[model samples]
Target: MTTAYLYVLHGRRGKIPESNLELLAGFIADEGQLGRIAFLEGDEQTLEDGIRDLQGRPGVDHLAIVPVLLYSATHIRWDIPERSAKVLDPSITVTVTEPLAGTAAVERYLERTLGAAVTAFPGRRVLLIAHGTPHFPEPFEELKELASRVGRTIGVEVVPTNHVGHPTIEETLADEHGPFIVERLFLTDGRLAAKMKARVQAIESGDVFLPTLEDDPVIINAIRERLAEAGV
Candidate 1:
């Protein structure tokens, strides 16, 4: 049976930034493999439709779905599996890989990103902003540990905050004095990055906002590793 790969995302406003996902898909297709993008929310194409379309392809039977998410939130914990189960054909073999949050590649990416921020603005506290889930605390806690680990590795202090839960970005910024380096932990550059940038700008604390992790080679390598693990 012919195998195809699908990268699932929580697209913003029916759109996503031009990032490594596009590049990976193109490269996969060039290598004679199938790669497709699917979204769980927004007005963009849905995951179910994407699966159906891929299954309809001639001789395609195995589908490897990689959730292009940084954290194991509700999307990866429940939504994707539940939705994919509903739409996949009986004869199709499907495998869903783990999210990118806890992966070594991601940790390296965070460490590298935070390292650069610390170098650029020495003595400034680093604030890591993540889009957390309100229903569960595990994801946010994971982020906290992640930040702490990265901080220890880089010999800097990294404060973790969420846009959805306690110690919100606004509250953290308001509580802290002096300039800070704000790093948004998003999978791609989209509305969330824009919104966070705007928020930091409005604070006027001279907080330096790091650029979004778009087309980062580290991230692309992380995805490649996931695909390899899944035997894609």
Candidate 2:
């Protein structure tokens, strides 16, 4: 079945964030599979457009809406699916992949990031930050669990928190052992990531920021694997 890869990004005013565009282009490059990719920055391309385009293609039966987000939060359970459900037809099968960090793929990414940060800041702790919801506290718990698993894998201590969750970065940085390494569990350098990074840096000048998942070979490979799992 012919399938299209729909990239759902956290963009504003329908404009592709600078670094995100570069990362997306890179994701469609040599090593990454799913050559036919369509970027949807916020509402850049509505579900109607995607469904129409796919329906126009002969023999097309599947559409994979793969969110490049790092966590399985509200966006995964609500926003992305709600939007896609609007235009999906019974004739076509739709598969939306799980958020990035929850999958096994993230294990390697987290381990690699922790390993690198530890190498640079030998005695520092890891602060794994993600955008979490307040009322729906499950995601925060997921982040905490993920952090613990990653910390165990790499033999380090990880402190997980949502931007608006308890134990704010300031608290974590201040209360936790000094010289904390701020690791971003994000997909791109969007406003969310940038603002949070700036906030963390303002709090602690010496903190280190590990690379966001954006367009990394590992991330792209992980996405590619997810797309293939949609039975494309």
Candidate 3:
């Protein structure tokens, strides 16, 4: 049997506050299946190196890197593959899985993260916030579509806004009537997420601020589903 190993590659933030990548790494390792997590941004060695280190214990033949990324950004398209190739082993079959977006997996995560807000206030609006880069806007667009899908599923008015693509998040926060719930929509709790959270705090009616995708247990299943979808 050719053993498989899963490396959950995470985007770089200043630190590992978002998913507690280190903790999840341990969790997946302890699960003792083909599950493992690697935060690309972490100071640890590359996925290939990790597999090489494991060579003595088990003769692994397959490796899959499940991107813990929320966007289809450059990191997904370029950085991960390039680095993986640099450290590739001729023996191990490597697979880079799809980035998470516009799927039932994401909707489930939204439900768990914001389930409390679904019925917390009778008429509060849901503001889904995401970030974008000047070079590309597709990431934000993709997230907007996912937000709409989630809103329809939950039967709520979801206003999709971007922190970088536009100032729409501020507009959504200012224009929305009465109390509103803010969901900082990203995996990492980095500078931008922090700024958005602070802005939400400034709003008197921004009563409920749900957790970001970082360090949440629900994320594990979501990643697993994506990996399964890719036949990992």
Highest TM-score scorer: 1
Could you estimate the TM-score for every candidate?
0.88, 0.83, 0.79
Write down the lDDT of every candidate, Cα atoms only.
0.80, 0.71, 0.68
Task: Give candidate 1 misplaced runs (Cα > 4 Å).
Answer: 13-21, 42-44, 201-204
Better of 1 and 2 by TM-score: 1
Which runs in model 3 stand beyond 4 Å of their true positions?
11-18, 34-36, 46-48, 51-58, 112-115, 171-178, 188-192, 201-205
The TM-score measured for candidate 1 stands at 0.88
Whole-model alpha-carbon lDDT for candidate 3: 0.68
* lDDT, ranked from best to worst: 1, 2, 3
Backbone clash numbers for all candidates listed: 0, 0, 2
Candidate 1 overall lDDT versus native: 0.80
> Looking at model 2, which ten-residue stretch has the lowest summed lDDT?
31-40
Model 3 vs. true fold: TM: 0.79
* Model 1 per-residue lDDT at 118: 87
Error of 3 at 109 (Å): 3.1
